[model samples]
Target: MTELDVKDWLVVESLQSGIPLTDRPYAVLAEGIGMDEGEFIRRTADLEARGIIRRMGLRIRHHQAGVKGNIMVVWRVPEARIEEVGQLLAKQSSISHCYERPMHPELPYNVYSMVHAPDPEAARVEVIRLAELTGIDDYKMLTTVRELKKSTPVYQRPEE
Candidate 1:
């Protein structure tokens, strides 16, 4: 992979959560990094084209935005049908995340998804609908009781 420049990394860090909503956000970002607007926009586009950055956009915490509950849902899907079932679950807007995890030999579920909603009951309804749609008769729903830590920075410096 191509290494990112100091300006590119600075852009990434500055855009972690607060991306300014302006006509020329990159220009604004460039000013912050002591570069001219044109250079900032050009380099940012280059970084995106190289896949150094996935996307630059808003990061919203649904819970803080009045989504008061989140449900961790697990489905006992057959290995052969894991992908199909996961795709089905992922299609639901209510499901923000979905993945297939290794099942505990003693446990009854394997496919997992996280659904965010305004309340626990709303989340339950979504899970039930998903199960019905996927023909998954066996599943478990675990509502989050508390969040220990929610936000973390992605970039880390290499150790000396």
Candidate 2:
């Protein structure tokens, strides 16, 4: 697969806010980057195929969109069943992020997942359902009372 060129990176940077909502958004972006519409579309397709760009769409802040609570759930799943439970939890649309982490001998929690909902009760319900599905009777659900920091800056430095 061909790697992303300078123009491709420029296109991605330009799309951080999302593609323009004009009748011809791609064309607008192409013109901004001094490229024709066909070239812009072709480069975007190639970037996607190569997994350089995941998707071009709206980036919504859930809290601003009526989601009042964000919960981080940690489960003490048995080693043998971690993958199964993780997969099950990941399949739920309520789960915005999910992953398995190494558990310390002193700390028994391993599998971790995140669920965002309109309220704490809704988030708790989803976590309870996950526990039932995974047969994880013991788990800790930590709801963020306040967001300290929640911004992901665009990384500009390339690894040496």
Candidate 3:
């Protein structure tokens, strides 16, 4: 893992939630974090190359964009064909995220997906279509009854 210095952590903390919406957002951010624009850009690029930052992009609020329903679909995919099925599900427009995980003693599901839609029925319809497309019959949808927490994890050095 790439280690972050104090200044790097400060920059990460400043951008943990959001970036300024402006013509020169990075310049504005660097000013806020007490760094010049050129250094800020260079450090960000270095972080990316070192794997300290995997991705930096906008996370659109699905509900704000008129997607009202979101369901967590867990599928019991056979170990033999997990890769093929996961790739197919991940490619779907309706499926925002698809992951393959290990099976447990009690839990039979190994593949999971998040499907968001305009309504419950729409989400269910997408799940059905996704099941057909992935060629996996065993699956279940855990409806998002309550949003307890939603956040992006941020890391910073403890104050000395």
Per-model C-alpha RMSD? 2.8, 2.6, 2.4
By TM-score, who's the top model here?
Answer: 3
lDDT of 1 by residue, 56-78 (tens): 75667776788876889888998
User: Lowest-lDDT window of 10 residues in candidate 2?
Assistant: 151-160
Task: State the lDDT of candidate 2 residue by residue for 35-59, as single tens digits.
Answer: 8999888888887888877776566
Question: Each candidate's lDDT (Cα)?
Answer: 0.79, 0.80, 0.85
Error of 1 at 116 (Å): 3.0
Ranking by lDDT: 3, 2, 1
Collision count for each candidate, in order: 0, 0, 0
| Candidate 3 lDDT, 66-160, residue by residue in tens | 88879999999888898889888878888888898878868889998899889989999988988888788898899988889998776777787
Off by over 4 Å in 2: 105-107, 155-160
Higher-TM-score candidate of 2 and 3: 3
Question: Which consecutive 10 residues in model 1 have the weakest lDDT in total?
Answer: 151-160
